[model samples]
Target chain A: MKLDEFHLERIQSQWENIVDYNLSESGVEPLRLNELVPHNRLQREILETKLGYPQTNGSIPLRRNVSSLYEGATEDHVLVTNGGSEANMVSIWNMLHESDDRDEVVVELPNYMQIWGYSRAFGANVKSFWLTEGDGAWLPDIEGLKDMVSKKTNLIALCNPNNPTGATMKEEHLKAIAEIAEDCGAWILSDEIYRGAELVEQRTPTMWDYYDRVLVTSGLSKAYGLPGLRIGWIACKDEDKVRDLWSYSDYTSIAPSMLGDRLGQMALEPAMREFIEKRTKRILKENWAAMEKWLGENEDIMTCIPPEAAPVCLVKYSESIKSTELAESLIQEKSVLVAPGDHFLLPQTIRIGYGHDKKKLVKGLSLTADFLRGEE
Target chain B: MKLDEFHLERIQSQWENIVDYNLSESGVEPLRLNELVPHNRLQREILETKLGYPQTNGSIPLRRNVSSLYEGATEDHVLVTNGGSEANMVSIWNMLHESDDRDEVVVELPNYMQIWGYSRAFGANVKSFWLTEGDGAWLPDIEGLKDMVSKKTNLIALCNPNNPTGATMKEEHLKAIAEIAEDCGAWILSDEIYRGAELVEQRTPTMWDYYDRVLVTSGLSKAYGLPGLRIGWIACKDEDKVRDLWSYSDYTSIAPSMLGDRLGQMALEPAMREFIEKRTKRILKENWAAMEKWLGENEDIMTCIPPEAAPVCLVKYSESIKSTELAESLIQEKSVLVAPGDHFLLPQTIRIGYGHDKKKLVKGLSLTADFLRGEE
Candidate 1:
């Protein structure tokens, strides 16, 4: 039961609110309740909701809405959870528990570190492959993934539209990864929380279509900009596997908040879903312009491979200071909070979240750039 | 990583929603949102809440309110979680992780089995002591607990105003249990979720005053009838330990829902807290009359030690049928859902929840009595 600290979340939980500019968040500026429920009729329904426990897995309407996002799936294929974090926790816990011999887990790196820390705590022998910058985008090292998998690997954990780097694996790459997992008989746990907040028009492809054993985890936190709801889900083709995962949640948190389930269903209804998606894209599009300008201005001291999706991008800096030290300096001297690359196991870099108030983000970036130049 | 199914929760989760009379719930009839937020000023604040992540541990106001329930505690001593279930999950997970050599956990029974299953799944050597029916009350066997503990005992888990049986441990019993735990240098995890729902005037005494190493887990779920909010917390004397537990939550569910924190603050505000407590007592007092009448009518076939607290009482039946079989028969023949004693690790009994609509409670009890007498 010994566990290593999940430094990425630890640092944020401590400093995100304390700093003047919190560039540690991975989602866009959130929507207010009034904004989410604009109509009087729906607001009445929400207001009348009894503060009783919702269905442990999810309300049928909520699960039905979640299932609609994926192709040819239904409510039976989904198990709703507190957030994308628990979705991964239950999936990995189940995968490890289901097999007596498969104690190994292969994880994709330069990603959020929840699964990495949890898997290791649960006694899995964890291995990793990385996504490296190349040819104007962050590319998966598929060859490395192939070399890492074996009969012992029970799960291949992934985060697409990845954290920090904001890299999205192509459909072809997903298919290749699925093929490798198929050969070794490992389940693919693809985290698609950031799939909808793309910089481009085309939505990022899900790993659902690529593998029969895939369990895709996503939520309203990132793409829909509703982290306050704490709504997330896991969708698998195997109904029995989904039921088994639902049982595991009985130990974690019995059920999602009743309001979360109701509000989440409204947020995912066709028109409302379209509205939230548009808001995310608009925010990203607006903020990315400022982010690009900031990067352009700081090219002398820093550089970044532009992110394809999500509110965050990893900026590599040319500095002798350690990533944690730089992050500490930013908090102490600049009153800014950027996720320290050291926490993500990628030192000499920092992850910047540019999804809030544009003016504040620009000012925060300017202050960070000034600090990098050793300016007053 | 292997886990036994939490049968108590699994059975309720499957049938609670489908049953015509759901006596499976442990709390009173839930309050509507309008009832909770009756004032226009507070309703405005709720409506304006941005759908963003609240402070990870808890909003300071929420923690302050939670700490107010215990003597000489502050926000520094609290860690808010999704529910009392996760509160237990984090505490047991932390206890097992804190020491490499101390792996033994002793639990109180028959009780809610969350920690029993979770501690075992985390590789602890779990043992148990029980409360037996005696002197017209359910009493803890203090000597049995003394005999069970040793140097390797890392934790002693207890539920006060205990589940299933609704027995409240006296301060003397709690002190005795604390002494035994102190001899073994073990921490005490007291699930006090049912602390305030007393049938008698005096509220159940918490273990906080009796033990230094105790982590008391309680929430709005049971006593306050606000399970839909999914708000719970842990209170400990050590601030560092509270912070450590918060870090562990980073990998589970990162934070409680935003509205949960905000509305939870309102719910715990002195005036609102008193109002909710009165409501619970009123409901419990009224429902207990019906429950008592039914027990009197059915004394030929069944009997129960009158509950001291909570919305539930364990009924010992004279039927030869197993508890699970009796529960299955009730569900199939009468569309009623009562928690079977087999799920609580005690047989020849069933736990009945009589906290909702009075008419339904009377009807459900009548049907159950008819079944017992073979008079249908």
Candidate 2:
């Protein structure tokens, strides 16, 4: 009935018209239309074919592709949604509805805004586990996380290869979090949107592998670079929980776009799988190199905890400038767009995405460097 | 988290395999798609060129076209949604959210299931205003509705040119109901899915003309014969309510399908509008005649209150046969699917849809006649 201002959406709205050079984007250098698979001929054929209503859960082919991404997961365990946003919302709502005493949610701060936004929307008390800059890395305080968990905690939401900070949790840390969740009968909702884009790994071990209560939400948007298609899925081992989420899903979005489902399936094909993996590696390698070079040239004004996986890396600004002011100045003077750290609850940092057009990345970072040096 | 069985989804759900006849269904009395459009290249171009995200509320071009159907309406007053289903859901949720005390919803019984389903999903107390056989026509009793209205009633939902009964509310009666809604400070949600398929007249005046609180939900699915496109819109006179619904719309569905929006715009174009009007008149005229003739031949076994609009009419079965049993028998023996009236809260009746191909209708009716005559 009554809704508070959607904090993240409001921020997005503010930047909607300020398009100059988007240096602040959080995803991998987004794939151009030509970068997508099946070639133009195949895409044309798909567009020409009459697209009927997609299966509300997901197209079987797409679900099968997503299922293969998990070790023991089946098509039955996956529910394709509008996007990762809907996937997260449905999973959280289901978890909250399942336990009345579980009215609180624990999320890692300096994470994606939706993790906290959705938790708050469900009327849950959200406690954020801070990720701090120490020992040359942005690492989560596992002890803080332990303290945040309680008998009333229904969900523990985490973003692996985390947004903005790009902080990733190792298998040991995930297992530790899973143990706490299991003990308290809480579900661990690990947002793996940046899963496949990891710089060094073939794949990250999801929380779902460690605990049946864990729910993994991911989509083709980030790793596969198909945000325009708007296809996402939730993988859960609990059949009852899956069913409950499906029912709630019906009330939210009856079904995902049929065209998107088809494209997602194509993008997940065995051959396409290899293509995306190679593509992600290439993009990450180039972008990270560009970022390292730029940061080296501007060491006096900026420093970053190198990202382990995702294309995004958080760079702390000099004490002379606020992150927002620096970001605004960079945009206005250099026509470069980079996200301010405040969006991720870290005010002293700015998020720079290396994944973009190689030329644009080079040009934008140069402009950013020049702007910082008063050479613009 | 523990969820109730009713809330949990069962694996391999039933809804997916329901044999949606709307897809690829055609017969001798075929609903020819070409008859409605005469092969317009512009429509095809629009569908093909339609890409990228649609406006969150709706595509301005499509919304403008939809607004033209209403007197003094503008694009700002329309909120495009996934379908009539989503439109109805948004309006109901918004209305219930606006006032806490008015948490109950009154809906016309023997109407579409979605009307009540959405109300119940929103935690609204749902009470039905029944349509009984005491009336020569299937009409809502004004007195019954008056008695049903209470201080707690926040919304009232109805379908004009009703789903199962093909009952159309008179303009005077609609005005009276609108007056009651205004007096009680409740919102009126009119499902006008079959708006243009009137048997004789052009169409009834929409409730929107008389009340600022009325929300008219319609789609291209039924009368426009574009169900495959999956496009719908809600028109509200109040700008504040429109804004509120649009804000809620973002969280529910980020946007309607872009391709669907483009197709909807083309479908409402001047030429397409003329085609739809002509095709609707022809189909209803022929279908009504066929139904009348079938009823004339089987007067003793079954009878119907001749419908004024919509493609469906309820025929009362003889007291000897249960409506559900008769419907099941028809489906099993003849492969002619007709909904059991009990699904619409009419136990002694079965809904017969004459919107299918003429030969299918003839065969179906003949099969019914033979069954009644003890031939099958």
Candidate 3:
């Protein structure tokens, strides 16, 4: 029952709202309800929705829409959850529960730590392989993962279009990782919540395409700009696997909110899905300019790998201060908030989220620069 | 990492939509979004809400409204969760996490099995005390609970306006239970989700009034008829205990949905809260009449203790068939679904939900009666 504190979430939960310029958000400015349901017919349908439990797994249409994102998947392959957080939580729990002998978890590091924290919480022997910085790209250590996993590994977790660094794994690399997991006979849980919010034209590859024993967890929170809906899902090739995950979710939050399911279904309709993704790309493009300018201005004190996807990039600082202390100082002195690298198990770095409010992003960046200069 | 199947929820999830008549639902007909936000001001506010993560712990106004339900409490004393289900899940997890030595959970049985299942799932030694049927009331076995608890009992969980039986423990009895928990210095978790849906005029007593070491879990899903909103909260006297519970929720579902937080605040505005409760009372009153008539007409084959609260009642059937078999038959032959008493650890009975449409209720009841008599 003992859980090490999830420092990233705990710090954000405490400071995100109170900070004057919060640069800690990792998704684009969220969609307002009217924008999400632009047509009167859809709005009316939403209003008419009985605030009842939607299908506990997910409504058929919602699941169907979610399934459409993955080739050859059907409604049976999906289980809708409250958020991507739960999607990862349930999938991990299910994988851990499915096999009694395999109690070890291998994780991709410099990633979102939800899986890492939860794996440890569930009493797994959590081992990690890092995403190392080299030549302006954060690269996954496939060979390291090959060495780290074993017959005892029940699950291997990955965050594609990875958190903090926003570095993505190529299809070939994902295949190699999948093969590593397969060698150990472990299920792969790929957290692809950042799939569509790519900086480049090529869509990031999914672990689902490479492995039979894969559970892909994604939601509207990151790429789709609908975090408030709290609609996330776990998709697998095997219908029974998804069904088993749904049973685990039954013990968590029973169902997604009614509006989340209905509106989320609308958001995932082919055209609307394209529109939301395009909007995310557009916003990320616009905001990244301000971030680029700030990084350019503070090149003497800060450097970043330039995120390939997602709305965030981790900047390694030139100063010797601890990442937590640096982040705390930013909050106390400049009223700006950014995720400290310490929470991601990397020190002397900070993750800047540039997905929300261009002006605030600029102001937050400028204030952060001021703080960095003062430290110097 | 293994969990017992949550039969009640599993069965309901599978058949609630498939059945022609679903009497397995425990709450009244859910409120549509339009009904929940009838006023234009509220509607506009909802439409304008940016679908982003609200405060992860819940928005200030929502927590304030939740705290308002308990005397001498503040927003600091409350943590908004996905549903009353998560409220209980987090509270139990927190209590178990807080103390390592205490691993046993004493539960009130013939109850909603969520806490029971989750307690065992979390690796706690789960013990139970029963609710005995006597003189048309389901009475708590307080003495039996005292016998069940010890220094090792970490928590005691209760359902007020109890599930299945619609039983409400008197305030004096609740105090006695609290004193028994106090003896072992254990936390008490009272699921008050069904508190407001009483058939009688008097409100059900709350554990918050009696015990300092108590977590009262309630939400809009049940008594308020807003299951779709999925807004639930935990209220405790100690500010720090609520804070600790919020940390566990960080690993579950980070926050309630954005619309849930916003609209839930409006729903809990004093006037709106009163209106919703009155509407629930009205629906229960109108529907229970038809239920009463059906009970009277079928007295020869079926008997019920006449529930004092909630929209559900457990009907004891004369047939010797297993409760699961009878429920399966009801679903297959009658196209009606009722919760099997076996799911609640009591056989030869079925829990009927009569809070929805009265016509459907009547039809479902008549079909149930036909099914019961045919077994003769």
Q: Score the docking of each candidate (DockQ).
A: 0.80, 0.24, 0.77
Q: Which stretches in model 3 have alpha-carbon errors above 4 Å?
A: none
Where model 1 places Cα greater than 4 Å from the true spot, the runs are none
Model 1 per-residue lDDT tens digits across residues B1-376: 4579999899999998999998888999998998999988877778889999999999999999999999999999999999999999999989898789899999999899999998888788999999998999999999888888899999999999999899999989998999999989999999999998999878899999999999999999999999999999999999999989998999998999999998888889999999999999999999999999999988989999999999999999998889999889989999888899999988999999988888888988888887777666
What is the DockQ (computed on Cα atoms) for candidate 3?
0.77
Error of 1 at B366 (Å): 1.0
Instruction: Tell me the tens digit of each residue's lDDT in model 2 across A336-372.
Output: 7777777677777778877766788788888877766
DockQ winner, 1 or 3? 1
Residue pairs that clash (backbone atoms under 3 angstroms), model 3: A51-B228
Candidate maximizing TM-score: 1
Estimate the TM-score of every prediction: 0.99, 0.83, 0.99
Docking class of 3: medium
lDDT of 2 by residue, B1-376 (tens): 3332221112113322442221112111222333433455642453344234455577789999999988889998998887776788678766866666888889987786765765675567998786655566877777788888888888888788787777788888798889888777778888888888788565866887777778899987667766545577899887777877876665555567655676678779888777776776688789778879989988988889987777788888785777667666665565555666766777877777786566667777787778767786
Model 2, position A189, has a per-residue lDDT of 91
- In candidate 1, position A264 carries an lDDT of 96
Q: Write the per-residue lDDT of candidate 1 for residues A1-376, one digit (tens) a residue.
A: 4479888898899998888898888899999999999878877778889999999999999999999998999999999999888898888888887789999999999879999899988888999999987888899999999999999999999999899898888989999999999999999999999999999777888999899999999999999999999999999999988989998999999999999999999999999999999999999999999999999998999999988899999999997789999999999999999998998899999999999999989999999999999998
